[model samples]
Target: MSADFAGETARLYARFRRDLPSDQAAELAAQLGLTADDLLLDLGCGTGQLTAPLLPHCAGAVAVDPEPGMLTGLRDRGLPGVVAVLGADTDLPQLGRVLPPLGALVVGNALHWTDEASALAAGAALLRPGGGLAVVTQGPPLWLGGAPWQQAVRAVLEQFLGPVTATCGSDAAALADRVGLLEAQGLTVRVSSWRADHPVDAAWVLGHLGSALPGDALTSGGLRQALEDELDRQTGPLVEQVLTTAVVARRT
Candidate 1:
């Protein structure tokens, strides 16, 4: 857990990050054969983005994240049947001692942060027989390689952050690696996608970047104004089609 997603940064993340789709949750529930007795374990929950929507589909949810600040305010967000825990992928075995039998285990946009193979193995151990495991990629950031408007955003970001690429283990090669891991455990891999479109303005870009960069000088030292100036000139549809990919499989 980095300070980038802690304290004030966590608040920005909670406010700016989009909620995970209910349709996707439903899909996982069906694939996992979720019953009223099964609980969903949401690793890297990050303010319950996956947990809240998933809770209704399962008996209850165990939302875990390593960042303590990131775990704050999840309970007050009108979520019932949600238990937030400050833990990480590496702690799954110990965490499992206190958790119920899981019908599904979801790692949403957080696989790149740890030893992915180990995390996947630990997650598998916690599942009940015939349960499902899903790894979701939250897609690239808004300023990731794209149209000219985004190129301009990228340029400004590069000036401050020094050569950034949106490689978050969502690419084809990373997916293949994940699929192989699941197959090693005798779980057949199935990949699915859910998409949400976000139109970027200066404010939206600022919030999104702020969430990721928090406390960085990128939004300071006059770079914020420069980014705004650069964006003001680019004219085209700047909608970011966030294609959320789910690499899923069931225990066979």
Candidate 2:
């Protein structure tokens, strides 16, 4: 992991709590075919965004992250069937020892941050025979139930992130390879993708980008003003985004 990632993540989590939707969790849980007897280990589980939705599908959850603040938020949610653990991706052996053999292991957008090979190796160890590993990445700017806003957000994000067409980790494919690793351990691997029409308000967009914006250079109001101006220039009055993804290998 990069030296700055942890600090950046803490700030991002504070912002994400407001902007990110829980619906993606439901989608992921469904895709993995989560069952009542399943024990899921959530990799890079941030503030229980994915953890909360998995509660209904699984008997229990092990939410892991290096950030204490993120775990605190998950705790604050008062979610049932959740056990939040603080650790890094390489700490999987310790995690495995803490939680029993898991039926499924999952990571949301943060899968990009971990060492893919190590993660795959660790996940293979954690899941029992025929267990599954779901590595998912979300991308493209879109608005909830608003086409115009979606266009606006896309334009703004492209400009902000600098010509990024999609959001996928450099190691996304390797992370998915965990399915093959599990297969070697006796599990069937299923790789797939899904789309969702996610919704969000202007405040949602602003909060999502808040922490990443350089506060020393621009005040909160200033950043908001800039974003509003950009949105106006890109798409005026109502926008909706098409939420797309590459979900690789949900081991069955």
Candidate 3:
């Protein structure tokens, strides 16, 4: 299945969606054996959150995503050694022919939206003999089971949206499934994880929720009011724990 973001949703994603922490990016680079000479491929590089940080570690980068708005945001950054492309994982074969063989391929928090096996195969085909593939995922959303305020936020979402499944594959079951799939592809898999706390205010929370949910769901229904009421009751800035997990594999 393909997902596209535009208009207000794209705006909210560009503004509020957090980037992979610099330190975490470094650790992931080390795991992938990334170097200054290797070309990096950031698949589904939404607004360049995961693309920007990984640029310095590699020789250059080609960031690709299907959404035009996301590509626009990446292009706006004008990052050196980075080129944003409008395409999906399935387009990588053609990309490989024009561009040099990639040293690394990264699917950051966007693998769940595509057919995993097909995407992974396409990515592996683009990588050089010993190149690596890193799937960077921020474990289950902060609002799902983290803090009191976030738990309250989850309740509000469920109340309006019914049972909610996170768009990003953040849960333990999903992680296990991903690892199994990668292993099945004849690639060696290794995982690294760490937790981070991000300061969040009402606006950040609202923008984050808006990016994930449809506009009408929040505005037309009573969901928006309920969400606002919950946020208003909170005492101070919510310190949310962002758990990041990186699954690294080699094309060997």
- Give the per-residue lDDT of model 3 (tens digit) for 60-164: 999999988888888888899888899998898889889888889999889987898888878877778778898888757656756899989988989888877
Instruction: For candidate 2, write residues 1-252 as lDDT tens digits.
Output: 122334555556555543224565566666666678989888888776567766777899988988786787678778887888888789998878867788778776676577866776787688765566776554432322236555565555545444534334523454356555655645555555555544555666665555434343223335457667766565343334444353434444
Top of the candidates by TM-score: 3
What residue runs in model 3 are displaced by over 4 Å at the alpha carbon?
A: none
Q: TM-scores across all candidates?
A: 0.93, 0.74, 0.94
Q: What is the C-alpha lDDT of each candidate?
A: 0.81, 0.61, 0.84
Q: What is the lDDT of residue 26 in candidate 2?
A: 64
Model 2 ranges off by over 4 Å: 1-33, 141-187, 211-223, 232-237, 240-252
Better of 2 and 3 by lDDT: 3
Instruction: Give candidate 1 misplaced runs (Cα > 4 Å).
Output: 1-3
lDDT of 1 at 44: 88
TM-score for candidate 2, please give it.
0.74
